[model samples]
Target: MNVADDDDPPPIVVPEVTVTAGGAVTEGAGAVFTVAAEPAPDAPLSVNVTVGQDGDFGASTGSRTVTVGTGGTATLTVATVDDDADERDGSLSVTVDSGDGYTVSSGHASATVNVADDDDPPPIVVPEVSVADASIVEGEMGALSPLEFRVALSEASEQDVTVRYVIRSGTATDGLDYWGGTGQVTIGAGRTSGLIGMNVKDDILWEGDETLTVELTDADGAVIADGRATGTIIDDDD
Candidate 1:
């Protein structure tokens, strides 16, 4: 198409080389940020990435250069500093400065680098001690058996532990429904389990079901995960 001197068919328009913004990083850590250009430039594209000194965390990395290859892309590393002190999180600005022959793409103009505090995580606390479950059978009207109430720990303790156990009142009575199944249960040193049993009474009652709930009373040395457990008595007389 031909045109007047003032309106000569507009010269062929070429897409200006463009670059986008970068990314964030943490304190005392290293992170790589990338900037991308549209069409490859005829020469190497050097982008000035300005990192304003916002705080101690982000000040570690100041003004840096990103060299875009003929392929139209480059990466810059942002190093952080972890000042092992209790401080609030900080941040810095990383902006793509307007260069010689490139345009800062929309939204690729700037980005933020967050500097997180370096604090040691709290120690993990778990249930170190626990108790074992117990089961017993009811004999005749008056019979005593090992209604073993076992006490245990997740791992063995360094020294012997004497945990007290008692036949706590439950759906079944202590004297009326069962016998002595309570007292100090001794766990030997470096042992995970300790046992204490009680005599369960079988009062030949055709009742439905009776329960003896055994519990640990003394937790002097170790912690208690499950301090209580129930023992069931089945009626045999039909």
Candidate 2:
């Protein structure tokens, strides 16, 4: 015959816990967190969980209790708050809290959820710059003629815009008919137009009316639209 031994039952072992995110999280969108246990818990386990966010993230539940069934895995939906304010990308964290029936893993106890900003940034726009043609009359005897050309922009800029102008010979000769050279014209901030000056030499010669070209290129803070303009030198000695 066998007698029953007077002894206590074996101690219950707790399951190790780990937290992981299901997918991506973004503003105006929600996400899920999976709490898993190793070895498939024999009985239901109650685990405490804490959620946190920072930067541009929205609101979320602070702390709650989750149940892990015998299947060893449980999931919870984490709600995200939405806002219209433009912001940068944020982060979300879910941590497994120490509880009675569960043990937190040293490496997998917490999980990070990257939250993306849904609000769009302002659009980038650059104004277009253009130049207009003008004519100057050659004065009799020895005199100087002022040929002023108009350079304009499509819209006013917050900063100064620099436009490069190069003189090209068309029907006129450089240094003989007019001051032909390359230079830059700067349109000041909040201004829409600027003037480019060219000096035409006056001489008592029978030279006919001639034309020259001014080309705009390499404009900073703006785009060149009407890049080329014609300058006419009216002959007064003819």
Candidate 3:
């Protein structure tokens, strides 16, 4: 792109400067460059843009003082600094390399910036809980699919926790052998496991094997996974 015509009598009017970029940003986030001080009207000129790095994606190449206003365009910005080391996407190299009246043309001078990588975010897991045990056979009759106590998390629940349970009496007796409550169990968001719903009753009279106890008291965001759970109701007779 060569443009210099005022009837070509004014020494050819040469003022070439080129660079452009935008898209692919992250890492203290900041990227934008479109410095084009070509040979147009020949009025405003002043360029000082030098930034070049190949260690890959920022280590140098950042400086600016462009004012080609009058439609010649002038905008340069590239900034990134934040590392925890874990990368595989980086690039940087912008030139107008040196400035003084400007004269950098042979293919728009220079430009290349495509960066995106900000690693280090994953650490917050506190969990240790387990509750699971059940067996039912009370001559089936009404509601018996309940008796499934299992709340486990040895480690994995970095957020969202509401575990609170109670139902004790190891010798069974709460309407018979199952169907006792004291609520709340929602362990989600990077969860580890959760489930507690007891219900078992279809009796006439014959109590043989019965034991009940499910305990895991308190947790409003995580930190109550120490353990306790027992459920068994077996007595199907005539």
**lDDT against the true structure, each candidate:** 0.67, 0.86, 0.72
- The sequence of per-residue lDDT tens digits that candidate 1 reaches over residues 138-193 is 67435665566666777776677778777776677878766765578667777888
Between prediction 1 and prediction 2, the one with superior lDDT is 2
The full ranking of all candidates by TM-score, starting with the best, is 2, 1, 3
lDDT tens per residue, model 2, 131-169: 999898897325887888899999999999999999898
Worst 10-residue lDDT window for candidate 1 reads 12-21
- TM-score (C-alpha, index-matched) for candidate 3: 0.38
- Ordering by lDDT: 2, 3, 1
- Please give the range of 10 consecutive residues that has the lowest summed lDDT in model 3: 53-62
Off by over 4 Å in 1: 1-127, 140-142
What residue runs in model 2 are displaced by over 4 Å at the alpha carbon? 1-5, 23-30, 38-46, 52-61, 79-91, 113-124, 132-150, 156-162, 168-173, 183-213, 217-221, 228-238
**C-alpha TM-score for every candidate:** 0.43, 0.60, 0.38
RMSD (CA, Å), each prediction: 13.7, 5.8, 11.7
Best-matching candidate per lDDT: 2
Task: Give a tens-digit lDDT track for model 3, residues 1-238.
Answer: 9997766454655667787876767766667778887664367777777776554555555665667766788777777776777677676657775566667777867777777677755665566666777666664546564667778777676677778888887888887666787887887878788888878776677778788888888877666645576888777765
Better by TM-score, candidate 3 or 2? 2
What overall lDDT, based on C-alpha atoms, would model 1 receive against the true structure? 0.67
Q: Residue 179 of candidate 3: its Cα lDDT?
A: 72
